[model samples]
Target: MNEKQLEQMKNGKGFIAALDQSGGSTPKALALYGVTEDQYSGEEEMFDLVHDMRTRIITAPAFDSEQIIGAILFEQTMDREIEGLYTADYLYEKKGVVPFLKVDNGLDAEENGVQKMKPIADLEDKLRRANERNIFGTKMRSVIKEPNEEGIKAVVEQQFELGRQIMNAGLVPIIEPEVDINSSNKEKCEEMLKEEILKHLNELNEDDRVMLKLTIPTVANTYTELIEHPNVVRVVALSGGYEIDEANRKLSENNGLIASFSRALTQDLNVNQTDEEFNNKMSATVNSIYQASIT
Candidate 1:
């Protein structure tokens, strides 16, 4: 029997620092933080930057535990040992923050202008690993580009399909279908996205509960219904390349949407800061985001 126990995902009214960048976006993030090719002698040596970045990300929650309730870590950092302590355990035991793992294999180009998350190979193995480690939750992200009703519905359906598997494995799943902010038809796309997501959730039994990480829509308070959905334990927003201030502005317009921001959360921290400076900057940023999440 799978005796792995699941703790309740009590992260409804909270902020999740998103540091789960895959290979394609990691280099750009490193560059923003002043980690450049010059630091490494060769391509094989580049992981050092990622290592340092992960260390900082893991450490930040300790400074502002009240502001961040959870974090979603990349696969590379999920179970990593920092100074002989497991990263997830350190977040929960020391800082009171939950740790979620990013389990998607990344994205693959599909027939439409949109993309799909690559199929998770041997996902059962991954979930078992998370269960063994006592990780709190899991997240998967797929993108929506244009307002094709069929294509958007397909993405939401696939996300929830994977979500059911995650839930059955005893993990809370955050189903993130990120609609591109650059699209000309964003309002139309959001309406379609909302319709399709509700369509699927209505089919699910009462036991099928999940979280949502979405783009901050321009229409004010439109997601109040989604946030209030009984099956939706929480509804969070993604920065999706928006500046942190702008992301906060849109997030504030909706009553219940909080933040699961990746770039926006980490954009301000620099590689050259002293330890004191780094923690101060991180704490300050978290305070700003936390304030936005509640108000």
Candidate 2:
């Protein structure tokens, strides 16, 4: 939907729901949320979720469409394949749906990992298929190396090239500007983002649309920085490694901007928990974001 349409939906009670979970948990969480077997197996399940959510928003006066956004973060180690991501796009196509994709941002050298370019190419091919099948448009998000002056320039150049490839193939690229709350100075982080945005604007053509992600402590703060840059079509507020409720509250107040989340949705779902508990946590997180958007 156009921003005006989205605003209209938000004005009349809409909610954005985001699920921050590993790829392995996504199907189970959808099932726990009352996604029917037929819907789950068929191509329409994604749309069903969006359609059902829209109904809930319209019926609930306290919510708005802008309040609803859905997200999933796939861990690098997870065995879940690329099809899961395409399924997400299918969900996005339904009216009143916005989805964000998150990949792990390695902050420490031990945690840092790389996704091969080949996998990304495969993902693009799947995205093309999803579009051909009339699935929803989902945005892609990733974190590159942290920004030193030279590193930022190189990353921006590489991202611009990648963005061109993605747009050429007809998909939205959501690039995460590296922000290490633990290591990077806040003012320096903000400056890096500003420079990156300027770089993107200089490189992007008039027809190009780019979705950029940033990790910020609050929605209000992120919105203030992002609104200053016209090229930034969406800004996802990072959850700052907090609890889901704290994250949701911040995102609720700043619902107009795109939001990305991680950790909170996945912390409980490791090898230790039962599938049922994992599903519950996932559903709760998704519902929490949905409810927050309405507030």
Candidate 3:
């Protein structure tokens, strides 16, 4: 682990930029960025287009360390370059932003009211390459749709188990067990999630720490204890499906949580915008999320 970036993460006041949308989510992400299905033909070309979008965002002036402390990259992005430097190096060296890699392949089919991550057949090799590429940490995700105790417990256990592997590989893990925003019993799901996370957090050794990326809870300050826990490096909130303004508002109400937004962060940007227009919109996006993070 890079001690400097770790310290920044422990105390940074800005939000994390979740630019890690994968193969499954790339089309929708591109669509919102004003690119349509007809824009790219095959999977390879689709990924190439999305990579171009990511490069544009990363190189924008407003996407700097001042208001965006960290960025999470997809594995493909990690293997790519930006302005003659590897993506992670470009982020930390040129932009002063810490970089993280999204390590999970994708989610499994829903079972027991939740969707766990699929088996990561190459997690070790991936982590090795991530470290070589100057990544500071990693993020992986699973989803919860109901408040079933057994289901939630399984989700948390799977997350922590992978988290330990990430830590042993010398990288912090952002353990995300996202509660579906549209779930019928969302509040109940969050309550159960909190309990499960706390149990695993308590079991960690003194030096073991991890980040949490959760869906913004129904109530303000719902994860206050998690934020204060010694084993938790930071608690970040995902936008789920909330619009930017609504996500920012909910984030501001939560005293210590910060945003790790994907869609909300890029919804205002379009593929056809001029560089000046894109940068201007990025400035506004960064400023709003930064304010909410600090509030």
- Cα lDDT computed for each candidate against the true fold: 0.79, 0.47, 0.95
Candidates ranked by TM-score: 3, 1, 2
Give TM-scores for every candidate, taking all chains together and pairing residue i with residue i.
0.92, 0.57, 0.99
Segments in model 2 whose C-alpha atoms lie over 4 Å from true places: 1-66, 70-124, 133-147, 217-225, 248-258, 265-295
Among all windows of 10 consecutive residues in model 2, the one with the lowest summed lDDT is: 109-118
Candidate 1: stretches off by over 4 Å: 1-13, 41-44, 61-64
Q: Which 10 consecutive residues of model 1 have the lowest summed lDDT?
A: 1-10
Q: What is candidate 1's local distance difference test score?
A: 0.79
Positional deviation of residue 172's Cα in model 2 after best superposition, in angstroms: 2.0
Query: Of the candidates shown, which would achieve the greatest lDDT relative to the real structure?
Result: 3
Positional deviation of residue 48's Cα in model 3 after best superposition, in angstroms: 1.6
lDDT of 2 by residue, 133-237 (tens): 433233343443344566555555655666667667655566655455554455564576566667666667776666665655322554455545555556555
Residue pairs in clash, model 1: none
Tens-place lDDT per residue, model 1, 1-295, is 1212122233444588887886677778888888886776653455557767878867764343577777887766766776677777777777677778889988878646467899898789889988777787789989988988778978998999999999999888999999899989888888888989888889888977788889998697777878888888778889999999998888877887888888888888899988788888787777778778986
